[model samples]
Target: MAAKAHLQEQIRQLPHRPGVYKYFDDEGIIYVGKAVDLRKRVSSYFTKQDHNKKTQQLVKNIKRIEFTIVDNESDAFLLENNLIKQHQPKYNILLKDGKTYPYLCLTNERFPRLIPTRKKINDGSRYYGPYANLTAMNVVLELIRALYPLRTCTYNLTPENVAAGKFKVCLEYHLGNCKGPCEALQEEETYNQYIQQIRSILNGNLTIPKAYFRERMMAAAQEQQYELAHTLKKKLDRLDDFQAKSTVVNASLSNIDVFSIASNEKSSFINYLKVMNGSVILTQSLEVQKKLDEMDEEILPPLIMQMREEFESDSKEILTNVALPSLPLPGVTVSTPQIGDKRKLLELSIKNVLYLRKEKESMNDRSKDLNEVRIMETIKKDLRLTELPKHIECFDNSNFQGDNPVAAMVCFRNAKPSKKDYRHYHIKTVIGPNDFDSMYEVVTRRYRRLVDEGASLPQLVIVDGGKGQLSMAVKALKDLNLWGQIPVIGIAKRLEEIYVPNDPLPLYIDKKSESLRLFQRMRDEVHRFGITFHRNRRDAATLKTELTEVKGLGPATADKLLSKFKSVKKIRELSEAELVAEIGKAKARVLLSYFEQQEQAAE
Candidate 1:
């Protein structure tokens, strides 16, 4: 209590300005936060007036506060995002991602084909909008197919076919989107011109298409094809209407990104509106908690500069980059316009900002019930168990070939990892890289130790492998006289597959199923932990040759220093002065000279 009071006093002395803040739990575990006014924001949590149900809960658990003052609001915003991505605070409303939105891609081939996909491949393909609504995207696709009856088929029309005109036009040609190049009804030069026009339409150049359609309609009317002329005119009109609505937000601007930042004294939110060809294509929000003052301007300029630098260094992901202050260039009206299209875009962006703020407030209210309580309930019913699986133990084995085999067992309570209960074992029973046997040994050891201590057994055991691995697990449970007493299941490697005993092949649980994704997440985490442990073992084993039997350097510290420096050759190359620069000059000079002397003796 005295220590916490002292920490509170320290927090009160912080400046009432923009900065990042962090909260530590009673156990000294840190959760990061940001604040616009550090003094006021931090002080608010300790005051009786600020004690809401959620704030009171946070204050009760908080033991200390730490802060880093930044220059302005935007700096605080960018810093907060970076920290959130790093620490992932429990109280923060995190950005959620499951399945990626599909993109419409036109592949670059002799005969191109349009495809819908979530993944962005490196192959030469032109991708368009991350369309917010899939139904609308499909509508566009249908429209394209109806209007451009090109070869939707993947078949290549070779030189022989070009000369022979062997293939006949499909139903698509009759609809209109394509000239039957496969049937050689159109010359290559003429077909290429149509392709060029399609590209122009995609680039939002409406004039060329309007002119072409009008010309076609006029020619048909002259030839007394009244029905064709009227149909073409109707299609042309529809295209114009589609273009108008598409750019309702920013009709004049071609491509730009609009950013708006909103902040209260303690937190900030930035909304990014991605515009392409005068349309507000996508909007994303980033939230920041930091100290703010009236004098602070948005720090976007410097943050963007740093972002560009990181991008050049291949160290960061830059989704969109546009010149700040958005001015129109010589021939391009690139400036942030105050009227018409730009104003509409800005208005839409503001709406998005407000929408996210409201959504976050609602999420904060519901986050109290956001624990893996549902996970326990689902597993309990799924296994038809006597009690809820409040405590789950998952096991995984990792090895490279036959070397440095290791296994890990992770415990999850109420759907979160109990880090204190995680256990790793260097394979003792298994001599080779046999995952099944290794899993059995790992499970046996973990359970046997709990039994020896008279501790309660976990309600479930999850193996991170397929059916064969599950069989080994079942055998282990039988040996302990606990077969079927504790529910067990296996998660297969490929396609997030799952398998149970007596089941044929593997079953895929839908991504929308929270319980299933939770189980898969646990399995993946255990596998990752095991793999990490195995890598450390392998690295240690390989670096054994570089270790010094020096008096002051113990194996653990030697390993730490080696791991820190990576290789002995690099360590040897590091000058006595350089070594001092890295670890400390005192250790460097002595350590380097010692190594040099040893090397001379060995020679």
Candidate 2:
């Protein structure tokens, strides 16, 4: 408590300005975060009572707090990203992927070779991309090879080596894939020109190469060389297909970056698209596991700065679904579009982010289902049960403020609802709002019938009320001599404390535990079942009472009308002819006359 008071005093001294803050425990920095207002953001940790498990643990460990003031939000954003990278605080979100993306490196060698590489070192060679997918890099490499006869072999190819015949051309030269640059048969100037053309294409400009192929194809056909033209036509088609697929917006839109973000309780997803010449040259989608409960807007700016640096994006203009007052780069233009091609491009980026989020959620759901099997194990441990509660039943009693009392039992098998085994019972032995008596009657009837029929019994039984209801259920089980054969417990409404058969004090399960969640789900299911049954019974009773007042109409006839129209409201709306066809003229006239008088009296 003294430590907490000191921390509160420290928080009171924080300035209301934009900055980065670091949290330190005895071990070291556990978390680092950025905020628009230092005092407000840092205060929220101690001020808010509701936090996720990880946040609670983080707050519990903090022994000290520190802050660094920045000029504005942009500096704060960049500083936060750099600090996270440099320190890698234990509680900060980080991307899970480890594969370094591939790049097309133009090597600094004689007759420079085009190479696909994952490493970018400090060489004079220019690196084109850190492609999100290796396949995109390969397609570009294949197209470059098909367009120009570049060397594949790695030789020094120095003037002295070429003159001394240090290397000879291999099969590549014969196959028309290389121009024999190692043998000095191809000039350096000519090879460099082809390299320049490849660079242009790599920058998402395909117009020159496509035009060159089309012109050559047409010229060859005019020269009466059908085979050569056919070959050129195929290359042209490949280039056309590649261009068409990559061009998402107008082809004239160049040097632009688009970003979108989506977040849920656990993680944030961001998608980036680098557009040049109106085609998508690079695409990346990243998932950041959330810590400290950051919102979507708060998470996006730092991510944008990080991704822009990581992907080497130099676009002057950016499109995004999120506003960017925090990202105040001097030369950069960040805008959220309402209408036009820019809006479409922003929507496309958002679409990719949403799709990625949905895919991740589906995978998490599958993982959760597999993880739920462990929940049964957790239940077994938490309850000190002899075996896993693979089959469990929960009981709940419902009424309309002490009328129409009923009880329901819902079954769960393998941590999921087993609706087929669910049972709803009218309170046959209990009068008024006597939940304990109703629980006793339902428990005895349910298990005795199961025992007589030789049906499998549930491993665990739960009653919705506290010790009173649990005592009744326990008594029923003992009378049937099944008390020790099965486990029965009750949950109190106030704190959800679990009461066992003979225990005076309740056992408290962790609120965040999946076992507790499973228990809560069963409680909810039984409550729904009981309430629905009660409503139907009460409604049918009222309808029967009114029908009994119709002189010739009995409950049997009332039931027939209810089965057909589903409610008395619908039965009262039926025409004379419709009612007569069902119950004959005499009974129909009496029913209609009674309904008319009832409506007139109400009016």
Clashes found in each candidate (C-alpha, N, C closer than 3 A) = 22, 0
| Top candidate when judged by lDDT against the true structure | 2
In the predicted model 2, the residue pairs found to clash are none
Residue 111, model 1, lDDT: 60
**Once superposed on the true structure, which residue ranges of model 1 sit more than 4 Å away at CA?**
1-19, 24-31, 35-51, 63-76, 157-178, 183-186, 223-228, 244-603
TM-scores vs. true structure, each candidate: 0.43, 0.68
* Model 2, C-alpha of 80: deviation from truth (Å): 1.9
Candidate 2 backbone overlaps, count:
0
For each candidate in the order shown, give its overall lDDT on alpha carbons: 0.68, 0.87
Candidate 2 Cα misplacement greater than 4 A, ranges = 1-3, 48-57, 95-99, 370-410, 417-444, 447-603
lDDT of 2 by residue, 86-200 (tens): 7889898764433487899999988888999988889799998888888989989988888789998988889999999999999999999998988888999988878877888
